[model samples]
Target: MISNNIKIKTQDLNVYYGEKQALFNVNLDIHSKEVTALIGPSGCGKSTFIRCINRMNDVIDICKIDGSIKIDDKEIIDNNVDVVRLRESIGMVFQKPNPFPKSIYDNISYGPSIHGLADNKSDMDKIVENSLKKAALWEEVKDRLDEPGTGLSGGQQQRLCIARAISVNPEVILMDEPCSALDPIATAKIEELIDELKKSYTIVIVTHSMSQAVRVSQRTGFFHLGKIIEVDTTEKIFKNPGNQMTQDYITGRFG
Candidate 1:
């Protein structure tokens, strides 16, 4: 069992897509309420490692993973595990904003409704309000709650997705390049929101942008060729990386 201060810990993790291995002997620790960023070139297994946290790779039939992944000291990859509940506890936001084809109100309310989080209409309303407020979108969308979520602009839609993810009251939020699809202004907004969200939720993000990783993460892990080259404070990772590979990648010497 992990100590209370640690929110997540992975032990010697390995992932395979069919017979081809993508990640090898990956070990990591995530502290509560801190933001951890995974950075690397494409195909370096950064995203794959994050997906393993919540078992999201299960969505792909050929993907197979081996390791002990514990969240708050509970092993989540056990056989007969409740994947639905696991995912509910560990929410996710993707590279692209993917809100339901429903009203803004419905998008926020959907998760709580499905999870029986609210007892009645009034309770449901509160859930929606609180979630939207947490995502920094409530005030803007309050008057237009009935508006279709798709009607929102790109940044607003991404925030809506964040709101929807939080509606489940997750303890950990995994974000995969959440700002890659947005404009500079929208990306800045999301970065600000991420800084705020870290006050409550443990956030793990996979990012291709080194500056984005440096701007938002407390600890950054540099991965290459299915291995984590180094994990340290973001300041050290960028300014004084211990590994030659990490220095090379961050300095634009090579991926």
Candidate 2:
């Protein structure tokens, strides 16, 4: 069961890229220290919706957004919010593993160093070690900290990216189809990592795999054609969804 503690809240949220609108009236509450999954077909606004929470869409020249997404009771859509600092608080992991060309140790340390989260070299070392341990990659890459992050395998690279995202001690972690690029074994590892991560940080994942959603998320939201059809507990969303579209999608009638 999900706790009543809400870490993120969205109401009447909308997103547009030039003339094409991507989302419509998206209202959701993400519980603190819980995993919430966004499931939908390709281009159904799942990715767009998560981007709105952390203001990732602000980088695109054509993007425009309306409505409110609040974290810890503070509205993030307003101009007063410091986007760079807000991003440090809400870390993001992309669909593909995109680690910098730097060494593995530098990959994790860079964020903390830039954000001034570390006071010195020793603090940086501790942050890197802890982040890697949390991502379940410490033992595997501890000896190779000086090696290029890109030299890692697909799964390792993704995990390294996860370590980087958490190195700054973010409150929320947003994942967009994080396992789509990996093999089944790699996917399983990431899923297991996600399950463990929810104990410390609020996680919002956008995935196409319903089974993945069921495996990792406590809450599930079904999206379709630029709108959220329904949102509920993972079991309720999969086993007894209230909307016809949600039921059909879950039963594999159509994507």
Which candidate has the highest lDDT of all? 2
**lDDT over C-alpha atoms for residue 75 of model 2:** 97
Name model 2 segments beyond 4 Å from true.
none
List lDDT for all candidates, in order: 0.92, 0.94
Across 1-255, the per-residue lDDT of candidate 2 in tens digits comes to 579999999999989999999999899999999999999889999999989988989999999999999899999999899999999999899999999999999999999988999888898999999999999999999998999999999999999999999999999999999999999999999999998899999999999899999999999999998998899999899888999999999889984
What TM-score, computed on C-alpha atoms, does each candidate reach? 0.97, 0.98
- The digit string of per-residue lDDT tens for model 1 on 1-255 reads 112378999898999999999999998888888899999889999889888888889999999889888998999878788999998988999999999999999999899998999999999999999999999998999999999999999999999999999999999999999999999999998999999999889999999899999899989899999998899888899999999999999999993
Q: Model 1 RMSD to the real structure?
A: 2.2
Structure candidate 2, residue pairs in collision: none
RMSD of each: 2.2, 0.9
Where is the poorest 10-residue window by lDDT in model 1? 1-10
